[model samples]
Target: MPKNVLILHASPRLNGNSQTLAETFAAGAEAAGHWVSRISLAQAQISPCQACGYCRGHQHRCRLEDDMDKIYPAILGADCVALAAPLYFYDWPAQLKLAIDRLYAFGPEYSIRDKETVLLMTAADQNPQSFGGAEATYQLALVDYLRWRDRGRILVGGLNEAGAIEGHPALIDAYKLGYTI
Candidate 1:
Protein backbone atom coordinates (compact mmCIF):
# COMPACT_ATOMS: atom_id res chain seq x y z
CA MET A 1 0.00 0.00 0.00
CA PRO A 2 1.37 3.42 -0.88
CA LYS A 3 1.41 5.94 1.95
CA ASN A 4 2.31 9.58 2.45
CA VAL A 5 5.67 10.00 4.20
CA LEU A 6 6.73 13.34 5.63
CA ILE A 7 10.47 13.64 6.19
CA LEU A 8 11.97 16.34 8.40
CA HIS A 9 15.64 16.94 7.67
CA ALA A 10 16.85 18.81 10.70
CA SER A 11 20.53 18.95 10.01
CA PRO A 12 22.11 22.38 9.77
CA ARG A 13 24.63 21.60 7.09
CA LEU A 14 23.41 21.75 3.57
CA ASN A 15 25.06 18.42 2.72
CA GLY A 16 25.52 16.81 6.10
CA ASN A 17 25.55 13.11 6.81
CA SER A 18 22.07 13.16 8.24
CA GLN A 19 20.81 14.96 5.15
CA THR A 20 22.36 12.30 2.97
CA LEU A 21 20.72 9.61 5.01
CA ALA A 22 17.39 11.34 4.62
CA GLU A 23 17.83 11.52 0.87
CA THR A 24 18.59 7.84 0.73
CA PHE A 25 15.48 7.09 2.74
CA ALA A 26 13.42 9.27 0.46
CA ALA A 27 14.77 7.50 -2.57
CA GLY A 28 13.80 4.11 -1.27
CA ALA A 29 10.43 5.39 -0.18
CA GLU A 30 9.75 6.93 -3.58
CA ALA A 31 10.94 3.77 -5.32
CA ALA A 32 8.49 1.78 -3.26
CA GLY A 33 5.67 3.97 -4.58
CA HIS A 34 5.21 6.05 -1.43
CA TRP A 35 5.04 9.83 -1.63
CA VAL A 36 7.77 11.62 0.33
CA SER A 37 7.67 15.25 1.38
CA ARG A 38 10.67 16.83 3.07
CA ILE A 39 11.18 19.90 5.23
CA SER A 40 14.72 21.14 5.77
CA LEU A 41 14.79 23.15 8.95
CA ALA A 42 18.14 24.61 8.01
CA GLN A 43 16.52 26.34 5.09
CA ALA A 44 12.96 26.61 6.28
CA GLN A 45 11.63 29.61 8.17
CA ILE A 46 10.20 27.86 11.22
CA SER A 47 9.44 29.59 14.46
CA PRO A 48 9.64 28.23 18.00
CA CYS A 49 6.49 27.39 19.88
CA GLN A 50 5.09 30.36 21.78
CA ALA A 51 3.06 28.23 24.22
CA CYS A 52 0.27 30.83 24.20
CA GLY A 53 -2.36 28.07 24.32
CA TYR A 54 -3.44 28.89 20.80
CA CYS A 55 -3.63 25.23 19.97
CA ARG A 56 -5.88 24.30 22.86
CA GLY A 57 -9.35 23.50 21.47
CA HIS A 58 -8.18 25.11 18.27
CA GLN A 59 -8.29 21.94 16.24
CA HIS A 60 -4.55 21.41 16.77
CA ARG A 61 -3.76 24.62 15.01
CA CYS A 62 -1.01 26.86 16.31
CA ARG A 63 -1.47 30.60 16.40
CA LEU A 64 1.97 31.44 15.11
CA GLU A 65 1.99 32.13 11.38
CA ASP A 66 5.19 30.61 10.00
CA ASP A 67 6.45 27.84 7.76
CA MET A 68 5.02 25.30 10.17
CA ASP A 69 1.57 26.29 9.04
CA LYS A 70 2.31 24.54 5.80
CA ILE A 71 4.08 21.69 7.53
CA TYR A 72 1.21 21.19 9.93
CA PRO A 73 -1.21 20.56 7.11
CA ALA A 74 1.09 18.01 5.51
CA ILE A 75 1.65 16.30 8.82
CA LEU A 76 -2.06 16.04 9.40
CA GLY A 77 -2.33 14.14 6.13
CA ALA A 78 0.77 11.98 6.37
CA ASP A 79 0.84 8.32 7.29
CA CYS A 80 4.46 8.39 8.42
CA VAL A 81 6.79 11.09 9.74
CA ALA A 82 10.51 10.53 9.41
CA LEU A 83 12.99 12.63 11.40
CA ALA A 84 16.66 12.80 10.46
CA ALA A 85 19.15 14.91 12.37
CA PRO A 86 22.57 15.12 13.92
CA LEU A 87 23.19 15.00 17.66
CA TYR A 88 24.27 18.43 18.83
CA PHE A 89 25.49 18.02 22.41
CA TYR A 90 23.64 14.70 22.50
CA ASP A 91 20.39 16.43 21.56
CA TRP A 92 18.87 17.56 18.32
CA PRO A 93 20.15 20.76 16.72
CA ALA A 94 18.51 24.02 17.77
CA GLN A 95 16.45 24.32 14.60
CA LEU A 96 15.28 20.72 14.70
CA LYS A 97 14.35 20.99 18.36
CA LEU A 98 12.35 24.10 17.65
CA ALA A 99 10.48 22.49 14.79
CA ILE A 100 9.62 19.49 16.95
CA ASP A 101 8.47 21.58 19.89
CA ARG A 102 6.23 23.45 17.51
CA LEU A 103 4.59 20.21 16.51
CA TYR A 104 2.75 20.27 19.82
CA ALA A 105 -0.01 22.10 18.02
CA PHE A 106 -1.23 18.81 16.63
CA GLY A 107 -4.05 18.00 19.00
CA PRO A 108 -4.12 14.61 20.68
CA GLU A 109 -6.79 13.15 18.41
CA TYR A 110 -5.89 14.52 15.01
CA SER A 111 -3.08 12.77 13.17
CA ILE A 112 0.33 12.58 14.81
CA ARG A 113 -0.85 10.23 17.53
CA ASP A 114 -1.72 7.51 15.06
CA LYS A 115 1.00 7.88 12.47
CA GLU A 116 4.19 5.83 12.35
CA THR A 117 7.33 7.82 13.28
CA VAL A 118 10.90 7.08 12.26
CA LEU A 119 14.18 8.57 13.53
CA LEU A 120 17.70 8.79 12.16
CA MET A 121 20.48 10.43 14.15
CA THR A 122 24.14 10.99 13.40
CA ALA A 123 26.76 11.79 16.00
CA ALA A 124 30.41 12.69 16.16
CA ASP A 125 31.05 10.51 19.18
CA GLN A 126 31.38 6.78 18.82
CA ASN A 127 30.12 6.00 22.32
CA PRO A 128 27.25 3.58 22.44
CA GLN A 129 25.35 6.06 24.56
CA SER A 130 25.79 8.86 22.07
CA PHE A 131 22.17 8.57 21.10
CA GLY A 132 20.76 8.40 24.63
CA GLY A 133 19.27 11.89 24.65
CA ALA A 134 17.57 11.64 21.26
CA GLU A 135 16.51 8.04 21.80
CA ALA A 136 15.03 8.83 25.19
CA THR A 137 13.10 11.81 23.85
CA TYR A 138 11.84 9.86 20.86
CA GLN A 139 10.71 6.98 23.02
CA LEU A 140 9.13 9.19 25.63
CA ALA A 141 7.50 11.89 23.56
CA LEU A 142 6.70 10.25 20.24
CA VAL A 143 6.02 6.76 21.52
CA ASP A 144 4.84 7.06 25.09
CA TYR A 145 3.23 10.48 25.10
CA LEU A 146 2.02 10.95 21.56
CA ARG A 147 1.11 7.27 21.20
CA TRP A 148 2.55 7.18 17.68
CA ARG A 149 3.56 3.82 16.24
CA ASP A 150 7.30 3.15 16.21
CA ARG A 151 8.74 2.24 12.86
CA GLY A 152 12.43 2.16 13.93
CA ARG A 153 15.53 4.30 14.59
CA ILE A 154 18.92 4.54 12.92
CA LEU A 155 21.79 6.08 14.88
CA VAL A 156 25.06 6.57 13.07
CA GLY A 157 28.05 7.85 15.01
CA GLY A 158 31.70 8.86 14.44
CA LEU A 159 30.81 11.07 11.53
CA ASN A 160 31.20 14.72 12.37
CA GLU A 161 32.52 16.14 9.14
CA ALA A 162 30.24 16.64 6.21
CA GLY A 163 30.29 13.69 3.79
CA ALA A 164 32.08 11.54 6.37
CA ILE A 165 29.18 9.11 6.19
CA GLU A 166 29.45 8.92 2.45
CA GLY A 167 30.07 5.19 2.33
CA HIS A 168 28.73 4.19 5.72
CA PRO A 169 26.67 1.07 5.90
CA ALA A 170 24.06 2.92 7.89
CA LEU A 171 23.08 4.69 4.68
CA ILE A 172 22.16 1.34 3.25
CA ASP A 173 20.21 0.50 6.39
CA ALA A 174 18.39 3.79 6.11
CA TYR A 175 17.36 3.04 2.56
CA LYS A 176 16.23 -0.43 3.52
CA LEU A 177 14.21 0.95 6.37
CA GLY A 178 12.38 3.26 3.99
CA TYR A 179 11.99 0.52 1.44
CA THR A 180 10.30 -1.70 3.96
CA ILE A 181 8.18 1.04 5.46
Candidate 2:
Protein backbone atom coordinates (compact mmCIF):
# COMPACT_ATOMS: atom_id res chain seq x y z
CA MET A 1 0.00 0.00 0.00
CA PRO A 2 1.22 3.47 -0.87
CA LYS A 3 1.14 5.83 2.09
CA ASN A 4 1.10 9.60 2.05
CA VAL A 5 4.09 11.04 3.89
CA LEU A 6 4.51 14.69 4.85
CA ILE A 7 8.06 15.94 5.29
CA LEU A 8 8.40 19.18 7.15
CA HIS A 9 11.87 20.65 6.63
CA ALA A 10 12.44 23.31 9.24
CA SER A 11 15.92 24.46 8.40
CA PRO A 12 16.32 28.05 7.26
CA ARG A 13 19.21 27.10 5.03
CA LEU A 14 18.22 25.51 1.76
CA ASN A 15 21.09 23.06 1.61
CA GLY A 16 21.50 22.30 5.27
CA ASN A 17 22.48 18.87 6.52
CA SER A 18 19.02 18.31 7.92
CA GLN A 19 17.40 19.07 4.60
CA THR A 20 19.82 16.67 2.91
CA LEU A 21 18.73 13.88 5.23
CA ALA A 22 15.13 14.80 4.60
CA GLU A 23 15.65 14.64 0.86
CA THR A 24 17.29 11.26 1.15
CA PHE A 25 14.37 9.99 3.18
CA ALA A 26 11.91 11.38 0.68
CA ALA A 27 13.73 9.79 -2.20
CA GLY A 28 13.74 6.43 -0.49
CA ALA A 29 10.06 6.73 0.30
CA GLU A 30 9.24 7.64 -3.29
CA ALA A 31 11.33 4.76 -4.58
CA ALA A 32 9.22 2.50 -2.41
CA GLY A 33 6.05 3.81 -4.11
CA HIS A 34 4.93 6.17 -1.36
CA TRP A 35 3.77 9.72 -1.95
CA VAL A 36 5.97 12.35 -0.33
CA SER A 37 5.37 16.06 0.12
CA ARG A 38 8.28 18.10 1.43
CA ILE A 39 7.47 21.56 2.77
CA SER A 40 10.22 24.06 3.50
CA LEU A 41 9.18 26.23 6.38
CA ALA A 42 11.81 28.88 5.67
CA GLN A 43 10.39 29.66 2.28
CA ALA A 44 6.78 29.53 3.37
CA GLN A 45 4.84 32.34 4.96
CA ILE A 46 3.57 30.61 8.07
CA SER A 47 2.31 32.73 10.92
CA PRO A 48 2.47 31.92 14.59
CA CYS A 49 -0.68 30.90 16.40
CA GLN A 50 -2.33 33.48 18.61
CA ALA A 51 -4.08 31.75 21.47
CA CYS A 52 -7.44 33.44 21.05
CA GLY A 53 -9.25 30.23 21.87
CA TYR A 54 -11.14 30.65 18.61
CA CYS A 55 -10.24 27.23 17.27
CA ARG A 56 -11.24 25.55 20.49
CA GLY A 57 -14.54 27.39 20.49
CA HIS A 58 -15.39 26.87 16.85
CA GLN A 59 -15.17 23.21 15.87
CA HIS A 60 -11.39 22.78 15.54
CA ARG A 61 -10.54 25.44 12.99
CA CYS A 62 -8.25 28.46 13.14
CA ARG A 63 -9.51 31.96 12.49
CA LEU A 64 -6.20 33.37 11.31
CA GLU A 65 -5.80 32.90 7.57
CA ASP A 66 -2.27 32.15 6.35
CA ASP A 67 -0.06 29.37 4.98
CA MET A 68 -1.11 27.33 7.99
CA ASP A 69 -4.54 26.87 6.48
CA LYS A 70 -3.00 25.10 3.53
CA ILE A 71 -0.96 22.86 5.81
CA TYR A 72 -3.92 21.87 7.94
CA PRO A 73 -5.54 19.89 5.18
CA ALA A 74 -2.27 18.26 4.17
CA ILE A 75 -1.69 17.09 7.71
CA LEU A 76 -5.19 15.68 7.93
CA GLY A 77 -4.68 13.85 4.65
CA ALA A 78 -1.27 12.39 5.51
CA ASP A 79 -0.85 8.82 6.77
CA CYS A 80 2.53 9.67 8.24
CA VAL A 81 4.51 12.82 9.10
CA ALA A 82 8.29 13.24 9.20
CA LEU A 83 9.59 16.22 11.13
CA ALA A 84 13.09 16.98 9.86
CA ALA A 85 15.42 19.73 11.05
CA PRO A 86 18.82 20.58 12.43
CA LEU A 87 18.99 20.93 16.18
CA TYR A 88 19.05 24.58 17.16
CA PHE A 89 19.88 25.63 20.70
CA TYR A 90 18.65 22.29 22.00
CA ASP A 91 15.33 22.36 20.15
CA TRP A 92 13.76 22.63 16.73
CA PRO A 93 13.84 25.77 14.66
CA ALA A 94 11.25 28.34 15.64
CA GLN A 95 9.30 27.92 12.43
CA LEU A 96 8.82 24.19 12.92
CA LYS A 97 7.60 24.73 16.46
CA LEU A 98 5.24 27.36 15.13
CA ALA A 99 3.78 24.90 12.66
CA ILE A 100 3.32 22.34 15.38
CA ASP A 101 1.64 24.92 17.57
CA ARG A 102 -0.71 26.00 14.81
CA LEU A 103 -1.68 22.40 14.21
CA TYR A 104 -3.48 22.47 17.53
CA ALA A 105 -6.32 24.11 15.65
CA PHE A 106 -7.15 20.75 14.12
CA GLY A 107 -8.67 19.73 17.44
CA PRO A 108 -8.82 16.27 18.91
CA GLU A 109 -10.92 14.67 16.21
CA TYR A 110 -8.63 15.70 13.40
CA SER A 111 -5.48 15.19 15.44
CA ILE A 112 -2.82 12.64 14.44
CA ARG A 113 -4.04 10.03 16.85
CA ASP A 114 -3.37 6.97 14.74
CA LYS A 115 -0.89 8.45 12.31
CA GLU A 116 2.81 7.55 12.39
CA THR A 117 5.46 10.18 13.12
CA VAL A 118 9.20 10.07 12.49
CA LEU A 119 11.62 12.62 13.86
CA LEU A 120 14.78 13.24 11.84
CA MET A 121 17.42 15.63 13.11
CA THR A 122 21.06 16.57 12.53
CA ALA A 123 23.35 18.24 15.04
CA ALA A 124 26.83 19.70 15.12
CA ASP A 125 27.66 17.99 18.38
CA GLN A 126 28.71 14.39 18.32
CA ASN A 127 27.22 13.64 21.71
CA PRO A 128 23.95 11.75 21.72
CA GLN A 129 22.75 13.93 24.59
CA SER A 130 22.80 16.93 22.28
CA PHE A 131 19.48 15.98 20.76
CA GLY A 132 17.84 14.67 23.89
CA GLY A 133 16.06 17.87 24.76
CA ALA A 134 14.62 18.34 21.29
CA GLU A 135 13.58 14.69 21.06
CA ALA A 136 11.90 14.93 24.42
CA THR A 137 10.01 17.96 23.21
CA TYR A 138 8.62 16.00 20.27
CA GLN A 139 7.82 13.03 22.44
CA LEU A 140 5.85 15.26 24.77
CA ALA A 141 4.30 17.75 22.38
CA LEU A 142 3.61 15.76 19.20
CA VAL A 143 3.51 12.17 20.40
CA ASP A 144 1.58 12.85 23.58
CA TYR A 145 -0.68 15.62 22.35
CA LEU A 146 -1.61 14.12 19.00
CA ARG A 147 -1.32 10.57 20.31
CA TRP A 148 0.52 9.39 17.21
CA ARG A 149 2.39 6.12 17.01
CA ASP A 150 6.14 6.70 16.97
CA ARG A 151 7.60 4.97 13.95
CA GLY A 152 11.21 5.85 14.80
CA ARG A 153 13.77 8.64 15.17
CA ILE A 154 16.96 9.32 13.17
CA LEU A 155 19.53 11.65 14.68
CA VAL A 156 22.80 12.39 12.92
CA GLY A 157 25.30 14.12 15.13
CA GLY A 158 28.67 15.92 14.54
CA LEU A 159 27.58 17.34 11.24
CA ASN A 160 28.24 21.04 11.52
CA GLU A 161 28.70 22.01 7.90
CA ALA A 162 25.96 22.10 5.31
CA GLY A 163 25.03 18.82 3.59
CA ALA A 164 27.31 16.88 5.93
CA ILE A 165 24.62 14.30 6.64
CA GLU A 166 24.90 12.92 3.10
CA GLY A 167 27.73 10.57 4.01
CA HIS A 168 26.66 9.76 7.56
CA PRO A 169 25.52 6.31 8.64
CA ALA A 170 22.27 7.85 9.81
CA LEU A 171 21.44 8.54 6.18
CA ILE A 172 21.29 4.80 5.53
CA ASP A 173 19.01 4.39 8.52
CA ALA A 174 16.79 7.17 7.26
CA TYR A 175 16.58 5.57 3.84
CA LYS A 176 15.62 2.25 5.31
CA LEU A 177 13.06 3.89 7.54
CA GLY A 178 11.42 5.59 4.59
CA TYR A 179 11.44 2.51 2.39
CA THR A 180 10.05 0.33 5.15
CA ILE A 181 7.24 2.77 5.72
Report per-prediction Cα RMSD to one decimal: 1.3, 1.2
Q: Any residue pairs clashing in model 1, and if so which?
A: none
Candidate 1 segments exceeding 4 Å error: 108-111
lDDT of 2 by residue, 45-135 (tens): 8888898889988988898988887788888889999999989998888989989989778775655577899999999999999999999
**TM-score for every candidate vs. truth?**
0.94, 0.95
Tens-place lDDT digits, model 1, residues 59-118? 777888889877887878889999999999888788778888987787555456778999
For each candidate, how many residue pairs have backbone atoms clashing (under 3 Å)? 0, 0
> Residue 51 lDDT in model 1?
83
Lowest summed lDDT over 10 consecutive residues: which window, candidate 2?
A: 104-113
In angstroms, the error of model 1 at 83 is 0.3
